[model samples]
Target: MDSANIVVVSGLLIGLVYGSVGLLSGFCLLSSLRGFWAEGDGRLVRSYALAIGVAVAMTQLLAAGGFVDIGKSIYLQSSFSAPVMFFGGLLFGYGMVLSNGCGSRALVLLGRGNLRSFVVVVVLAIFAQMTLKGLIAPSRIAMVGASQTTTTANSVPALLAGAGLSATAARMLAASIISAALIIFAFAHQAFRRSPGQIAAGLVIGLLVAAGWFASGYLGADDFNPVPVTSLTFIAPIADALQYVMLSTGSTLNFGIVTVFGVFAGSLATALLTGRFQLEGFQSPRHMLRSGGGAALMGAGGVMAFGCSIGQGLTGFSTLALASLIAFAGILVGTAAGLRGALRVRPLAAA
Candidate 1:
């Protein structure tokens, strides 16, 4: 296939995998954190950790092998707005708790016949667009623009280089140290090793991260008319997908938007075939209102944060970008606050 076809096909396939995996594994950061906090379960949390580690190792390896350049991804941009990313992550984390799932996870749950997630996804997509280029985009743009901080050492390699290491040596050292730590944490538990589905979720998700890089870096690479290199981020795509639906005449379909659609379609297909499809709705008006509110927060926060859990958690983190780390930390804190009732509002547990 030609480069354009390659990008489209690759995006579709990636979305299919995400949908299938999400359907089967119930993979999601919101659920994982909830399970850990509310149910005293660490399996899903470890699974998520494994995914992050694998993403880091494989993505770094891909860069080291010259198969792709991690620097090309958005995470490593010279413009660094740490506060925006941090607050964005915080919003996404807290929103996920209120919604009871993150964006990608919501898609997966919807496939399993959860109508609640359907509302969440729709809200997320719509608000995400608003955050990206919709009516509220101006405020977001101004916020980020005013807070943006330019930095040469955006990536791990650059940071290491600043510490007096050569470029190649810095890259290798950073990769080894981080990967080793992640691997040890992920594999140290016998419980983790025993759960094949959870482990597979982590592994497959991580591979998909690398796959995104390869797709953009290799398959989508076109000197004549190259697209910006990116991976499986969800926030902006949720918005972009909505825009594409209305403006396909004047706009181009990007990998993120296409992949977002593909995941939903793939999940719907799977749900239908597996006899799991069911029409579901809210139990009360209160629930519907909460779902909508949660989705709005997701969209707005996701835009500020530059991604959702899957977007920043996997794709952004894969690049070993410093901003991704900040975002991740913020997500953790926000999730904790929401789950623990630390926020002014009722916590997830109380709700």
Candidate 2:
């Protein structure tokens, strides 16, 4: 097949896989964090950690095997604003808490018949578009430009190479160490391995990340016209999907938007078949307001950080970019702030 056809077909196939895996396993970062924090249930949280570990290992292996170039990913640009990415993560983390979920989680919940998620997704999409090439784009660009940092080694591989190691060796060493450690930690809990849903969530999510690389980097590869290589980032794509719905005439569907739609459709079908669909609503007006406000922060923050929890936490980290690390740190801090202590937000009481 020609490159364009390859890109389109690969994209669709990738979306299908993502939708299936996410629906079947209920993969989500916000849920994972909340479950652990509020209830002391760490299964989902560990599942997410397993996915991240697998992504890092597999992606590094791909780079070493010469199957894909990690540097080509957007997270590894020569210049990136540390402050922007950092603060962006903080905003996204905090927003996810208030919204009761992140963008991707909202999609999954919407599939399961949560109308509240519909509002969260809509507001997130609108604000994300505003941040990306929208009214807020100018200010964003200015801030990024002001705080951008130039670096000789944009990614971990490059850093290793600078330390007198070959690229291949660096990749192998990094992948081996990181992946092995994660697998050890995950499997150490025999009870965790016995939980099919959590295990499936980890494995399938990891595979989805790898599949994204195959779709965008390998299949989408074209000498003349190239599509930007990205995986499952939810913030901007939520906005882009909204725009595509309205301006179908001018806008072309991208990998992220297609995947987002596919997840909802797939999850909806699954929920129906499994009798999991239950129409749920907000407890109060305050709940609605907080959720909307959270969605707005997620949209803007995801744009600035260049990814959401899944975007930067999984896909960006998969690239092993220095920027991704900074973004992840920001995410942790923001999540902590929203979950506890001074930054903790009160839950909306039922009206």
Model 2, residue 215: C-alpha shift (Å): 1.0
Candidate 1 least-lDDT 10 residues:
342-351
Candidate 2 off by > 4 Å: none
Cand. 2 TM to true fold: 0.95
Highest TM-score scorer = 2
TM-score of each: 0.94, 0.95
Candidate 1 TM-score, true structure as reference: 0.94
The model with the greatest lDDT is: 2
Q: Write the per-residue lDDT of candidate 2 for residues 1-351, one digit (tens) a residue.
A: 766567666666666666656767767787787777988877778888899888988787776777776678889899999999999999999998898778887888788899999999999998888899889899999999999989989888788889999878877777777778877777777777888888878987887888888777777788797877777778877887888888899677778778888778877877898898999998888888999999999999999999999999999988889999899889878988898898798866558
lDDT of 2: 0.84
lDDT of 1 by residue, 294-350 (tens): 788888898888888888888888787899989887888888887886473353332
